[model samples]
Target: MKKHLIAITLILLLIAGGVIFYLAQGDKAKLAAGADTGKEPVFTAPRSELIPTINVAEVKVWTAGEKPVAAKGLALARFADGLAHPRSMLVLPNGDILVAETNSPPRPSGGLVDRVMNYLMNKAGAGVPSANRITLLRDADGDGRAEVKTPFLTGLNSPYGMALVDGTLYVANTDALMAFPYKEGETRITAKGRKILNLPANAPNMHWTKSLTAGPTGLLYVGVGSNSNIAEDGLEGEANRAAVLEVNPRTGDYRIYASGLRNPVGLAFEPKSGALWGVVNERDMLGSDLVPDYLTRIEFGGFYGWPWNYWGGYEDRRVQPQRPEVREYTKRPDYALGNHVAPLGLAFADKVKIGGAFANGAFVGLHGSWNRKPAAGYKVVFVPFAANGEVSKAKPVDVLTGFLDADGHARGRPVDVAGDAKGALLVSDDVGGVIWRVTGGK
Candidate 1:
């Protein structure tokens, strides 16, 4: 009996070793990063994985005197430091900056897969509890660094996007759209928040960050991500999700502005044509260079492919109950920012005075990727745009870099990018707890 038990144990160990070997030999990218970028990206065939590649960079906070490298002819400075996990920023009408210093809400435990992912995420410096507040930063002396930092709004639930429309500030929390009365030059909001709309944030909210932007007509557009990766949680679980919603702030009524976006994190309106645009994080586990995250014009009542298809009708066999009809209407994205870039923030350069190549374009904050080998997108990039509000054919140009050290340990991870009143770019580094300012040469 003892010999038999030993044989069984040895067999189990052999099986585990085999599984590890297979996962270690997971799909690799044959094409370079730029090959899967720009207006005509080369999409490779999907190489789905039973266990996706997990190559998260261990977090290492930046020491004093350390900062990101700006492009040639540009300068980088610390706008605000020593803050909680800052995710997004909004430039108030009075030139004050409001940053949402928050993190993910408490997530319920799943099975073994989720347990492993949680452990990896924590190691990547994203496990901290939500700060649940927006902090105000004022650079009153005009020296780039913030002089007065104070709590602007407190006791909120993982707030992210913020927009001021018609004297009211709209905050998109993880599960609801909140509104508060506001006035110019005020540092704090003592008024009670009104819950304008409840967003889709059910249990296991895989993508919980809701980005808000105001349209030209005073309508509010909110970017709601998918409940699950590729809708594996059943179609019923994705009702009104994976799409951008236009909300009426007064009546709390909303409609699906566009459908089939996997995770639209950043929304902005083009300055020239006033067309709404968004940066979408595409589906993962399809190898490293298959599906590229994209920036595209958000047309009303339009559909971009999600679970069923990708990159304009490239069918994903893994998604069940395939709707072949949906492929006919899948709108091809305008520009590909590269696969697994994880773009989070989008701001046009209409107000940005950074000259030369940075003159006419949009700034994107790439939050970095955990699934891709060699790690991609821990920096800020600028995608050039034409004068007519169309995306140029040029590949994205790096604006800020060196977030990772020689050992590939992440010193910081950028989350959002917005232009300050003085025409400089403000980048929120969530992991390093700093907001970096980038200005062009004099």
Candidate 2:
């Protein structure tokens, strides 16, 4: 009788798994892929799922001679290769490049849901252990490729963002902001990093990556993500999170500069107006088309809706004890990059000499999506900005393609974008472990 009972339970579990797989596959995207992109995208009604759509592209790293397709009149070449999940970058004053080859820290197992999500992420080329180091890539011969690649700094905790200010290098690790003294043309740093400030990095850090940038006034800005998706862990856990914090490097003091940005992974300053801007990844599980990720100018003390509202006051009814009043002050983003594009990098085109339509715009690295079916955003795109440093109503132009192959497998996934000393664009492909240089064609 015990044997029979055990057999029956196993069969039931299999049946349940099959049912879930069917439901997940059945949640097809109703709107077209790029329909929810641009200044005013179509906001379809919410189609929340008990099990959100799980359409992840399997990872197949590029073999020899494989490369992404550049846009018309643009040339592509490998800048540096054989990296380990290079997520962010900083080009030094002396033309040396620093690549933060890192990933998420170890996460505690949170029952079956967390385990399942981990499995899915592993399949999507994101489950590897953190590299915990930053590498220096130097091109001494004047060629585009880096002939000297060496470890610049080590013993970090999933460092993501990097900046050099006033002869000091600041790195945003998953849990702390660290600083190290540096000089021009230094290939490596052997000194220990001083902890400038502690960031919000509680356990099960859903959005673990912290982006950073230095303003002209020498103040540092760090972007911190929320602890939970839609405040499921309660609002208390999100204190000083989901916002950008301004820090004084001299004294280690910091304050919340802006609040309620869900996951501002990429922080940059517009050269013309000198205003801060960011690309945010919105909430998930609202079907494939509900919440569109955006790029916008981040104002001081500004609030872009998160758990309470989205897209300029569209309430997300999922949160318990919703703050209906929060909608009144919710600021809409300037431009939407479509739903679940997962933009992770933002760079202005002010110093970029890649002429033509790419001259006066912003280059964004859309890291691609896993929660939405008919996945979006595996390439880099250019969003044109006006002469006054404002993003226009025009749609984004694709700058790099072919990350996803014909069979929907990802050969590479773009993470961060930055302009090099020579005025060319450098894109980091974490999955393929390469930095690609895009320049004007001959």
Candidate 3:
């Protein structure tokens, strides 16, 4: 009886081995067949090569009559001659360009100090300067001529974000958000400035500039960056510094949409997925130690591990003492931009030009880096993404470079990107005080 049982077990084992061999052979045959049929690999992304899909664009180098237009890391346009330190820009429905000039108040100085009070010297000093208000200008034919130029709105502390909603212009000021009735292409702006939300903003801590974007959901999203590179809340201030606030246009109701952003400058929702996204400028003075600049989806109430952790599992010793507690729980960013590259403006390709390679892509205007000893990033990068909103397969291509010299000096810096009525990509440069348009190789 024992011999019979052993014989039966051997037979069963042989049968199992035969079945395993058969399955392996089948898999091999399928793989060979797939190779022959030119099918994509099963494990890899379906679309691996993320090429740009940009429409035909017209490039216009700014020129002040015979003299070339010039400035630095600024967004500017020829709205009107003699515009002072214009740094931000917006387009009205009627073809008017709103230029936000960041003018510093003249400091009271003694005569002896005034003579040595070189305006250039104060600028050379530190501390980010304040950009006060928006100046409206019009050029009917895009012909480098300002038909009208005037103050659309005034008395703003520091206006950074501008959006036109239902014939009303919403301005995101540093300390508060305000809006006024605005007609596109209107030569002058007379305001009955309505208060939208009063935020305790414009602190000297971590994040200062409050960027705003109107999402497809018809709600306004505001991004406020963190106060410090990696420090915990300052003494008595546990303010909502690094958060994205959602505001309703119809009812003026506002609340925190997302949290834990360092300094998000540009915000836009993916047209196809309705997913919120932003171009964030990471913190400075960490010796390239912590988080990289990132372009990621803004999930509600998500903490990006500011000052404590960064990227994926990288410990930031400067932000907190309990590194072990925060290390594993901290979430990493979707895409890791190179260190110290100050990414600023973002614009998703629109319907007019979103047909081909640009269908699911976005453009970023890097304001460039100053803290990086060598100072990198003075270009506009084109990041192409998959249709499902995943960033892994996205490619960061240099849509525009040539701004920095080989020896590490800045030639130009991009401020913002917009798709004009004709489906062309227009980039505004504050440093050169000009608007440059870019077109695909086609």
Candidate 4:
């Protein structure tokens, strides 16, 4: 009698599992059919008009100087176009490029309402036109070119940074830390996973994309931007905004890893030292030199003062009567990029072995500056790290440039950078709506 009961239960369980699998497959088919079909997508959050990345009518190769090929070592091979605002990129283990389009325009160009919408979002503390889907591009045929395209994930809220852990995909979406359950060869995000954690305060009255990176231990770290450039700064109000939070994808457990960082857009774990590193975009509206963007290692519970002190000893007069009691422990950034140079994308380049100046260095994509008297940072630069994984009196080399033209105009603004499984660095341009994959080292 007991054996008979067990057999019946086993048969029922098998049937239920098969049904779930069939339903999942059907859902993927429906999602893929809708993705990138140029159809209007429904959303869970409020929609606004501020699309930033411009989709070029044609893919053109641009060089810094008039000679077109003046820089022999550096060349931008445009991989794909028609992206709304390709803010962040994740090169998959299988060589497919996953691009997060942040705030792409509807009609493909700016409209009056769209511009107003963007402005209002910025004013109200949430800003920019953001992408709702993740795009997958593959050169499946190996024809020395890529012609295949597919939408991998959709309804993501301005997803910025992507980290693949074990088999799961962890995305840092603005206002939330999200996850996609996965396994090898899975086409769709079959499982919704978890919202994990929600961060409403990171809404950018200023700069907002909450980029994230996973470390060696399967721990996910997120970057939450400030409510405004350097306004009230939520010194004691919002705890996690303008800070980095380390998270566990499976369990949805989280903790504040660091604080007082204003918009740490890009983050990575050091290959040699196993330390967490981040590149931050400091506040604006002071002078070009007042608040310099920074790239530094993230220390737990460390404070890099914002709305008060910036780049170490430079006290910001705008936020006068600064907190005198809590100023001692502020750890100044190890190094500073040029003033107003918005450094965002970062990756520890141990895997990609390049010779010459950048043989043993990291690459940072400087998303061009806004409100600067002189425009700054529309290129990818290299910073050499010593044997100890620290910057040792090094200067940055321009690896990717020409986004700003001869007339000092910006063709595109770079947002994020990542290395492929083969060590090729990929740069995503939000302004140009394009993706450029840079391969260095054999």
Indicate which candidate wins on TM-score. Answer: 2
Candidate 1 has what TM-score?
Answer: 0.94
Tens digit of lDDT per residue, candidate 4, span 188-245?
A: 5646757878864432234557787887778888888776655654455456678898
**RMSD of each candidate relative to the true structure:** 4.4, 3.0, 21.3, 17.8
Superposed model 3: Cα runs more than 4 Å off? 1-83, 103-131, 142-149, 232-235, 249-252, 323-329, 351-359, 392-394, 440-442
> Could you give the candidate ranking by TM-score, starting with the highest?
2, 1, 4, 3
CA error at residue 191 for candidate 4, angstroms: 3.7
Model 2 segments more than 4 A misplaced: 1-20
Looking at candidate 4, the ten consecutive residues that score lowest on lDDT are 36-45
Give per-residue CA lDDT, model 3, range 1-442, as digits (tens).
9999768765655564354334323111112211211011122111111111111111222345522222222222333445544555676666567767653333333333232322322322212255476887666677545666677777787777877777878888776778888765566667668888876553443355678888766688888777665455542453666778899877779888876676777888777778888877765544422235878888887777665555545555555454567566655667655555678788887522633655567877877654443344567776777767665454466666766644453444577776655455566665555556454433
Q: Against the true structure, what is each candidate's TM-score?
A: 0.94, 0.95, 0.72, 0.76
lDDT agreement of model 3 with the native: 0.59
Candidate 1, residue 177: Cα displacement in angstroms equals 0.4
**Candidate 2 has which clashing residue pairs, if any?**
none
lDDT of 1 by residue, 1-442 (tens): 9999768755655565455436855666788768888999987778887767667789989999999999999999999999999998999888999999999888764444454556667879998899999999999999999999999999999999899999999999999999999999988999999999999988788898999999888999999999988888688989889999999998999999999999999999999989999999999888877679999999999899998998889999999988998889999999998889899999999878787788888999999988887678899999999888899999999999999989999999999999999999999999999999999976
